[model samples]
Target: MVVVAQQTPSGPSPLSVDELVSALELRTSWTLMRVALRSEKLPIGLGWKDLKANASETHSIAMKLRSFLRDYFEESVVTGERYVQIYEIDKALVATIVNACKAVVIPASPFSSKYPLPLNVNLLATAPSDPTLCDVRNHQNGDISFIFCSAGYYDDKNSYEYGQLPTHVQQTYVGIDKLVTVRKNYYQSYDVITLRTALDRLEISVDQPGRLGSLRFEARPMEILSACALHFQSLQGFGACPPENLFPAIAEMYGDHAAGKVVALAFRTMTGSVKRERMTTNDDDLRDERFHHAGMIAVGQDIKPYEIELDMEFTAPGGIAGVKLAGMMSQLASANPTLHGCYIKAHQFIAMEKALNRLMTFI
Candidate 1:
């Protein structure tokens, strides 16, 4: 019998790949031009009309304009030194010039056959809110509860998904489809006003640390913390986790410390913690507390008659406060069996924050 060989799946043809790369490059150039024009607030002249009028010319007007800008910028200099020179026409001006060139080169309709790639026409457009995407319920006590459900959960009998979602949402349905896969299992709700107030407090604290003492925690702290966790996830790449799972996980980790009292969470670098340590001669000097801890203190009766206050602290061992938090949680879980749940929650939060910070740099 003739030996039969196993067949492997075929990849895209080279021509197809080349076409995609070319299309993507063109799209990227157009996107950069649009961003530059909007950011610099550059004025568009009658360049397009002039180009159309000179369509019969042997040499295109667009090519002539581009050549002129290149020569002008190359010869211009603001400061000349032996080793270094600064251009008189800065990056912003160069961007403006490039955008002007694009006005002549690119057609007004981005969907034209000249550029085969799909153009994001609404890249700078202000998105309209979709009421159906989120459900907001108002309580008699004037507190509003908000629940953002994945669009897939509300699919019609015909299996057609949320037609009303924004165009971008429709394009990435494959990825978003996973988010609503188990929507019911992880569905969670939050008090809208309370959440907003907590975020406002966070913003103020970041701006003015001296005013931290005056900040109020009247709203549910879990709502605020959960929102932070969600923001962290969105910035990072954990977009797959549904709100239902994310909120409950946050509540379980820090909920006990935050419950029935005002709680403030802060990160300190490992170097700062080490500098604070006292010099000890003995080898057995108690190792500095490297895990989560809480203490209670009496803050007087004017503070809503609460008998005691909770001060929650977490120690990390690196220069970056976020990294230290992650390391501390790992050490805690390994050393103490009792704090396994707390470690899980804290680990997730720090990991999310790190991911978010990475994502911000790209933006």
Candidate 2:
């Protein structure tokens, strides 16, 4: 059950479970949702337009959903050595694993022959333990398959967009989906949560197992953005959609495993606000400090002087990334034009995929 505020023509009002199911259009015909897509059967659930007026943010969500539904996003791809491998895969085992996954998220039921043959797997798994959070199926070809992890999380909180906002360090991180930018005298602190999924546009992998019948599916970012957008809209006091808590990126992201070490080590200064000191420069400052290009550092390396990119690595003795000691980063762009800001990007020691055999399915 969801607890959300809705804005009706008469103002805010309560919404019933049935009303929510209809208004939110929970009933889809196929693919990601559980409902069937037979031509003869009428679609379930009334769309928001049919009910009360939806939140203004809902339109934004709709637009993002439309754009994000692509087969791939370069950011979501776990390039280089950003992946872990699995072993002992067999042709016979594939069916069992596939069937088990379907059962885990979908209930067994009798169906007609006209039932969609080989329906794509898309559904939430909230079993209270290691649940399936975000997934957008791309495609499947024999043993080779792929997917896009719509949900995104950084091991370091400061690397996230909302986390980069100029707010007190004591700001509450809870109810992140409810975060909205308040255009007041000073920027209001917001919870570090979503629609930020698209910001990461995190691309994962579809690895090929050795001499083994191993490989996998397809997915996208649109679904993830749409989900977060709904969650954001719900908090708008217009209509509550999927709450942010449903996303593992905000609800259960951890420094150890869920978020790879690459994401943890990343510190984002270039994209968001770059001011280090909150000391205001102007008297009529709506923002805490002046935003400079100090966060964006694109320079050349030692030998590759011509190679241009956000290549300059900000390094220090202990570590170049992290919120507490981030200021200690002395490595700035030298001989670089954009000297004001520092460069930060997810780094991997190796430049290629490294394989390690494990018994796990999810990474």
Candidate 3:
């Protein structure tokens, strides 16, 4: 059941449950609910008329139903991650919390038959436990196979995009199809050490590099997860999405075995964010110590030269060709002077597919 606020010429006003019922039943302009239990389908204790009434019992049931539905968002089924009170209502209303506006469906059944069939046996056992597996598990071949599917809306058409993930991180990560400008005032620039600090706080792991860009240490399970989460958050504004909790939940369910397998899968896949830009700055504001990048990095005077460092040890999945193409474009922008704009085109599914393929390879 949806509780909608009544709107006036000026703005929306707080509404009672009875008013929400009136709006829903009458299909009034105040109705914002797109889905609700029909009158006939109401639970045993409640009916359409009961919801419509202004009586105490009506309000009581309405509140109870609302509360009951709200509970759905409180606990994660797979990981048991509970939503904080601030986002409780909003989280419960949406299907999957990851990028609410993007309509990325993180499957409920994990056993539904859809596209992207025939998972690899190795990946199935290695994939972090989640409902996402439902899409592949229901298929006849899924017993020995696990599949991960990511769909994207480009312009308006849907297409399959995939990613290649790191071999050792046991997490699922996906990027949105849009670019999000980071709020310069809200966050400080983070280097590898600071980034690791944040990951440790969240109980995530990352590969322990002996030095910057060095592979002396194996990947930290949490650090890889953090990079995936941050990449997703940067590409798409935060909402009810739950990808952040995916890896940890798998760790809890299967203990170290799950964790180890996931990390291996991540490194093997090298899942990272990639985008195309027809591009690109950083300013160190003293008091607040915030970093700001302006225009395109290609044209911007504040462009950091160090970003060009290419540690090619990690292989990008989806396909080598696409990864190489993007890398080439980035290099071209950095070296060429007369180039006006650079176009970097990447499909989001590439990341998802890469992660899935690595999971399959490991399992």
Candidate 4:
């Protein structure tokens, strides 16, 4: 597991975001990543704040929320890079939470901004993943997850602006540099040995406040909150669940093991490779002869979105499907067109009948 520093631009930093982007060779584009839910149809009474996943991919509640959302969140009509995590909540419930009585959020996104008021529960919790893999005990009594996207979701590396998404963190990472800072007293380097030592010396108590929050996992405050929103959106998908039972389900996912590893990976180098090593120095040396600055850290290749997977298909080697599953695969072909092959989602494949449904020819 890679360990990077939780570097946030406060007053001023040594290395600049542009410099980091250039050094890391980051793919500079406005791509809106995804976080999926395990259900059918969108949640109810939810309103649209921006554009839907697909213009053709519908969401009925959006149309209904138009007028009401005007007061809460103003839709984005500008131009530039932005992103959207596919989820929202019941408008009535949201109204109640914001207007009537702010129900006690035992905890929002564990990494929410400290400066902000109303305690914006930033990071959305992810759930309904491979049930076999769930750590029920850890996440059972209330857990939070941030894995917001599934491999099948599409990402356009060129669309700086998401039709309806407001202008937000133009990129998943403010810059590749922010993530690669895994060294101590060194906020902008990727020295493997330094990282190993740093993690060893680091002490994080989930029971303690402010440690993880200071180690932010996402770019902007709202983006993280958007993540927290995705969790509620997923709850809406669990059909027919009585409110009595829902609270327990919510608690179970809170204590998940994701808090530790997921965060490290989010800031990991795109290729899992480090550039420069952190300058090693003794405690006395630091107090005596100051150490090197972040500007000196060496940069490596681009750091793509974490857990980004493409859903595609190919032919068997002997001319079955018509694709050679070989070589390095970075991205996908244009929308609707399989990169020289056909593709089907696992769910779609399972839903297909073993035999074809013969249609009658009515001439």
Candidate 5:
């Protein structure tokens, strides 16, 4: 039988995140053309034709890059074992790297602008060709995703004001562009390089206090965060983990085999308004607290809030429902009351947990 690797007290021979970063940076061209092509946002457009073309190009590049990166990461993770022969990236070290990766993300979408078109135009076009006929289609169809109608546009301030695409279309375009970036970065090789570099810098920052706050993973609002987690896991070599136990579990998995590693956990500690008179405010004081804490986590903060409510789920590596990942939510909740106080519907918990699990797998 093959023997597994172990860590020594000296810190697994010291993997240099800085060195890895230097290696990647030296070879990388973060210039406009490269970044745009890698981000798949190249060849900007103003009209529907150009926008459609951009979207098509994004899809094409995304598919190709995603396939290649999947294989690359698989090799990286499997070969991670070999790295240990010379130097092992400790679990805490890996955690720090991932946390750094969570920082410095910008939207890759080109479409978030407003679209200006009348909803009824499609109806008018479809109606019997009468010069006096005016399309009566619902202009807000695109605005509301479910409000689908025949081909059309929405007349909204966003698009009209910008002298560009309507609000809905702009939003959709930007949203799609961002999605394409997420798809490529999380699922493709170039994106993997960025992630690895981020992780490397993260570990270096951890070691060097002067750089502490430099590589921060911005917090995605709850809904987006959940979605992003799932998206990250879709990359080829990524695996899933239980939502609640994801961080700690992955921390352990990437930890040293011989000796336990020290993960540099950092996040801003919060202070909430506790006065009795302020409780009457309509703002969700408790929800706000939870939201803030989640943000801290996104940036790799190790914070304990006064109150919290955790909604989590678990699954097998392949996205199958298995044992529910438990314990951490309650444990963290005990540490932060805000976590314990939040209310998540049962179904929402199940769905979010699955989503979180899927995300962890991809990361």
Candidate 6:
């Protein structure tokens, strides 16, 4: 039974129980129940036309209906279970209620002869606490596999002229057809000292003997001048030679100059071996001469005589071989020729002087 009330100008007035019961009639359908509230003037026996005429009565009825719906839906039917219903209503007081049932309804079975076969599921467990192991696990799960291949063939005549293949049958050329079937574990470990020590050991194993020696040559002044001329010719493309006036040998070329003026010269070549040795001390300070010398000695061991050839020609005043030869001849004139007696023979002096004079005119 629904009870509705209306407010008057002076006080409150409500619908009697009989009027409320008569006004609302519940009609049931298969899925829901509905109640229609209409105006009292309508032939529908319930005289709600007067209620609608009064704005206050209409509002009162709306409020009462809302409260009644809430209570009816919330009530418990069984000892522990409550029946719930959802309802919708118009602003004019017409309402419909649907029974909300709780049941798990499953659809038709998806397994049939036409459906594709199910794939087997495999589960793998890896150590979650270790980051490396977890990475491996992720790699295993995310790994993808695929196959790709390509083949072709072509033929052409007059291949050389057109830059085409004459009779080339290129078949099954698998450039990168491979499958990564297994995973390999890689562990890398290296220490600066360890690597340096290993390299040092390798150097020591291949270390050869060190050589240290010098070579000296002595010849007549003329022969020396001739050699100088030839050497100068070889280096002509390098740079210009010094003028004749720079050489003292030019003075002896004329008859007016004195004879018996000889020259003595020597060339010394030295070769040293070098080897690498690991440092014994923890101190890496380069400022220490001892430490520096140790490294230098290792480097010195690698020097070979042939590899360290010193060309006096390029080291001369004019950076020309002729200029250097002239300077050597001048030094011979100022210094005592007898000092290098082992290299200077007595018979070679006069011949050397004459040769020196002739060579001077040639320059």
- lDDT tens digits, residues 318-352, model 4? 10000011111233122321121111112111111
C-alpha lDDT (0 to 100) for residue 159 of candidate 6: 20
Q: Considering summed lDDT, which 10 consecutive residues are worst modelled in model 2?
A: 186-195
Q: Which segments of candidate 2 are over 4 A away from where they belong?
A: 1-69, 73-81, 101-138, 143-363
Of 3 and 6, the candidate ahead on lDDT is: 3
Over 51-104, each residue of candidate 1 has an lDDT whose tens digit, in order, gives: 223322335453343332222111111000001001122344334333332222
- lDDT by residue for model 2 (237-303), tens: 3112222111112111122232222111222243332223322321222111123222222311111
Please tell me which model should have the higher lDDT, number 2 or number 5. Answer: 5
Candidate 6 ranges with C-alpha deviation above 4 Å: 1-185, 188-270, 286-363
TM-score of 4: 0.16
**Residues 284-319, candidate 5, lDDT per residue (tens digit)?**
332235554476466564343222122222344211
Total colliding residue pairs, candidate 6: 9
Model 3, residue 21: distance off in Å is 2.6
Worst 10 residues of 5 by lDDT: 78-87
On a 0 to 1 TM-score scale, where does candidate 5 land against the true structure?
A: 0.17
Q: In model 1, which residue pairs have backbone atoms overlapping below 3 Å?
A: 186-244
Q: Model 4, stretches more than 4 Å misplaced?
A: 1-94, 104-110, 113-238, 241-363
Higher-scoring candidate on TM-score, 1 or 5 = 5
| lDDT-based ranking | 5, 3, 1, 2, 6, 4
Of 2 and 3, the candidate ranking higher by lDDT: 3
Q: Candidate 2 — what's its lDDT?
A: 0.23
Q: Who is ahead in TM-score, 1 or 3?
A: 3
Model 6 residue pairs with clashes: 40-48, 40-49, 222-355, 222-356, 273-300, 273-301, 273-302, 274-301, 274-302
lDDT, residue 14, candidate 5: 25
What TM-score does structure 2 among the candidates reach?
0.19
RMSD of each: 26.6, 21.3, 25.5, 25.5, 23.7, 51.0
Error of 1 at 141 (Å): 1.4
